[model samples]
Target: MTDIQFDDRVAIVTGAGSGLGRGYALELARRGAKVVVNDLGGSPSGVGASASAAQRVVQEITDAGGEAVASTDSVATRAGGAAIVQTALDTWGKVDVLISNAGFLRNNRFEDLTDEEIDPIVDVHLKGAFYVGQPAYRAMRAGGYGRILFTGSSSGAFGHAWQANYAASKAGMIGLSNAVAIEGSAYGIQSNVLLPNALSRLEEVMTPGYMEIPAFAEALQSTDFSFADGRMTPEFTVPLAVYLVSEACTATQGIYSSNSGRYSRVRLAEAEGWVSPAGTTPPAVEDIGANFEEISELRDFSLPAHNYDEFTIAAKVARARGIHS
Candidate 1:
């Protein structure tokens, strides 16, 4: 395969101080994009901030002969988000790609998850993506060229224990990207979501005791990006990201799962079911049971663009059944 190169593109990557964000920053730099390295430089729990993490990644890129500037901005706030995009404009003129990789993990059972625990994760993971993407999205709409990527997780789309907060936040991103993709199509902006399964500080947050295990220690030192239980190195997830954000990508509103070199798209769909006329009274309990098989049929369906699409489908069903004029 021919090497994918960024050439004159400019990119903004959040949470670039370490882990998956670091890998994305380095890869984008190596591919010839001028990068804005953004990191709150906070701990995995989003407790405090520092500049060291962002600075180190910027240094790594610069030392390796790639162009980059460091910005310490919290994606949770509007002002901070605007400042991050401004950093790219001031340094490189415009933003062509955005990798919303900044995130944290805090795990607790559903009953034990408090407001403090849930709020920050939602703010950082979901709201943060909105904060940064809005300005860059506007810039892209004006320029008529941009790639926006939102980070999602398997936990929410699939399932995981002790991750209710994290899962819900990530799931929101899928809906966000779909809206962006639909609206941005005319302007040459492509928005997509990535559900990454990787090993990083975020993973460490989920399983704190793993580091102290001798077997885990030995495995970490010798592992070569294997997914023997679905554990993947951060490096394993970057190639797909690079492609998605590159100029070659024309696909949008797609959700992909990547890990250990395995990649696949996730589809959200609907099932065709029984329908009734709008003015009809509610059906009796026995009537519902009589139509159970029809309600569960999956032979045909409509993929509604939004919540209101259900109404349109209902109208069509009524017309087909001669219940409506």
Candidate 2:
């Protein structure tokens, strides 16, 4: 395989003060990309802010002979998001890459989640992407080149027992990424999502509860798993994050999951369901029950490329059922 480099590219990494975001910033800088390290410096539950978190990462990059600047702006507000993107444009004149990885956690059961908890998560993870993404997208369109990555989570894509708010927020990242990918296709821009499992302060807080389970505890201690440092440290995810937002990434709307040191693609496919026969009367509840097995089966499916794919697929199904020519 050939080496992947980001020479002369201007990249912005939000939440770069620590964890996976910091790892991405450092590696991108090392590979010749001028980085804008933006971090709100907030606590895990979205509580406070300080400049030190972002500034420290900036110092590390500069000390290593790399170019970077720190932005202590929040990704939760529209103005803050624009400011974060502006930090990059003001210094570099263009934005070639964006890693929208800034977010906070608020875990709770669905019934117990409050508006207060859910609102902040959505503001930072979902709206924040739009805030930063809008400006970066325009710059990319003008420059006619760009790569975008949204940090997603398994808690969102799958489900977690105590992370309803966080999960919902992360799931929105996938939808946002897909929309951007569709519109960006005409503008030399590509967008994708990353669901990474890395050890961070956020994980530190969540892991203890899972360790109480017997099977979970056993897996946690297993040596069969692979990781960048014998554990799910943030470094293991940096390379995959970097690639998704690099010139070398070929697919837009792609979703990748990084766990330990193993990487894999995550896709959303539409299952082909059973169609009522042409000229047949509407099925009653009992008729539907009789065909439930075929309806729920996953033997046939298609990965849609855009919103219109469903209509196209529907037309195909109708023709095959003799409903139309």
Candidate 3:
């Protein structure tokens, strides 16, 4: 197969100062993309900022003979998001790809989380994607070409202890990507979510003892997995991300996960549910309780592409039961 190249494409990667975001920025630049490396240079806990973080990445790209510019803008606010995109537009005239990867962790147990803790996590991860995505999406709609990738997390999709805020924020990215994918379909723009399990600064801060956990340790030692220095590094996850944000990737509304060398699709599926028989009095609570197993069974499941698809499935079942809307 021929190599995929960015060439004249302009890409924006938020939180590009370090970790996963930095890995993405560097790879995109290396592949011929004119990149806007946006980083607030904030601490892992979302406190403090400096220009050096973004500047260093930009300098690295330039030194490697790639085109890039630095934007030290926070993605947590609307103005900041717009400024980041504007930097890309002013520098390259158009944004062909967007990787909404800016975020910091503020992990806490559900009960212990205060507004102070919860708000910033939502602001930077969930709302931040929205803020940066909307403007870039608009630009893409006008140009009639774009690829968008939002950073999601297994903590949100599956579940993890003591990371309620982080999980909620990351999970929200799936919904955001779904909306953008549906809306942008007519404009030739695609949006997808990525759940990456890589060792990054944010992960380090959020799970200080992760390596000590038996499951993590065993996974690290597994022959089935591949890693650098016994850890899943951000670079290991970058290839998938780069492909998802490249023009060659035409899939939209996809949720994919990458850990170590394993890559897979994560989907939301609905089981074929029990429906009340026609001509029978409406099922009672007792009836529902008796049929609970059938209702919850996972056999013959279907993945709904959107809300209407659920209704379509319900209508089919209802019709089969001799009921009409």
Q: Scored by CA lDDT, what does every candidate get?
A: 0.88, 0.87, 0.90
Across 91-135, the per-residue lDDT of candidate 2 in tens digits comes to 999999999988888776567779998899899998899999999
Count backbone clashes in candidate 1.
0
Residues 138-157, candidate 1, lDDT per residue (tens digit)? Answer: 88887889999999998879
For every candidate in turn, the CA RMSD to the true structure comes to 5.3, 2.8, 3.1
Q: Candidates ranked by lDDT, best first?
A: 3, 1, 2
Q: What pairs collide in candidate 1?
A: none
Please give, for residues 1-325, the per-residue lDDT of candidate 3 as tens digits. Answer: 8788999999999999999999999999999999999999999999999999999999999999999999998999999999999998998799999999998887666787999999999999999998999899989998999999999999999877668899989889888899899999999999999999888787557654444557756765674543445559898899999999988887899999998767899998998788876765899999999999999999878889998899899878778667745
RMSD of 2: 2.8
Error of 3 at 308 (Å): 0.8
Q: Which run of 10 residues does model 1 get worst, by summed lDDT?
A: 207-216
Error of 1 at 261 (Å): 2.0
Query: In model 2, which range of ten residues has the least summed lDDT?
Result: 204-213
